[model samples]
Target: MRTTDVVRAAGGCVVRVGAAGLEVLLLHRVSPDEWRLPKGRVRPGEEPETAALREVREEAGVLAEILCPLDETEHQFTDRADSQRRTKRTIYFLMRPLSSTTAPTDPDFDQAVWLSPAEALARLTFDTERHVVGVALRLLLGQD
Candidate 1:
């Protein structure tokens, strides 16, 4: 069996639930024409929660507060760049936007939008990511 290790990363699922309804922040990947939550690899010496907050700001141009525990998922696939098989263990945190206005700041993402949780889950490219959004949505809505 080929030995493979899981890489740790942190990300945020920012949800704004209020009179406007439950809307989730989604970002389009620069290279792949797919919608996803704002996230990235955890930097060395950085805590996962801090990395999650940093990623949300860096990718979505939004400051958010960690509202709940980390939602985690693991995915195995070939690395897009090197084609080496690998597994990425992504730690996703539920966050609420601190400000009313938010946008994508990372050049890696071409666009950012707030959509209903159902729509976001349907539009997400990765199944694992979709599940993460579902869990985040439930947690944010106090249904979990």
Candidate 2:
């Protein structure tokens, strides 16, 4: 693997209980094919924990309280032109919604929806993201 830079990001699976058992919140975008949790780059002098919650509220419009840390996933991606190589490790967490409202004041995603963990697993676009969600789900289920 080529080492260009390491990026710090934080986000997590926001979960709630529904008739289906447990559901996770996911943000959707079509242009780049994204269907996963809200996450973003950690600003300078920012903690990953704080960044994760801020990104979640900014992208998903819901106020959530963190339950615990899920796991961190490292993924590498190259720009379409293959000019930039970067690796990002996102720290995922398990959170519970404190309120229900689409606050998307930042408008980073096209749409946001809550889906069962199984549905989220199938709809997620990246394997690493799926793994993160799976870990969070099992933690939520006491199976982890």
Candidate 3:
């Protein structure tokens, strides 16, 4: 029997803090319409934190300041091909927008919105990502 191992990739979570409290930036996938944080695969020769920041800008058209250390999550799921098991390693960092004027760009996200922590938690589709969001929320609110 041949054993196969899939490569894992890194990602980031872009968040914003404001007077209304901490709000997470969420994007709706074009196909599924599932809401999620702006994230993408870390490119070759890219630092995880840098990739996080780049992904946020590319996916959401937002430039933000990374405020804290990175948090990560790992899980096994079917690959995009849906024919093999793959582990996704997502590394996240808390970020604050430099300015309030920002919106997601083309191809990455169809729509973008800011949501309260509770609403974000409720709207997110993945459990692990949601947990990451929770951690980011706590960090942003100084609850952790």
Tens digits of lDDT, candidate 3, 1-144: 122444435555667666797778887888766887777667768887887788778777788778775578777777676578776677778777775766777574787778888888999988878988878767666797
lDDT of 1 at 109: 90
Candidate 1 ranges beyond 4 A from true positions: 1-4, 80-83
CA-lDDT, candidates in order: 0.84, 0.83, 0.74
Against the hidden reference, what TM-scores do the models get?
Answer: 0.87, 0.88, 0.83
Q: Roughly what TM-score does model 2 have, to 2 decimal places? A: 0.88
Give the CA lDDT, 0 to 100, for residue 137 in model 3. 69
Superposition error at 50 for model 2 (Å):
0.4
Across 40-100, the per-residue lDDT of candidate 1 in tens digits comes to: 8777788889999999898888899998765788877787778888888789998889977
Q: Write the per-residue lDDT of candidate 2 for residues 50-96, one digit (tens) a residue.
A: 99999888888888888988889888767455657788888988889
Which residue pairs collide, candidate 3? none
Residue 21, model 2: lDDT of 85
Show pairs that collide, candidate 2: 61-103
How do the candidates rank by TM-score, highest first? 2, 1, 3
Pick the TM-score winner.
Answer: 2
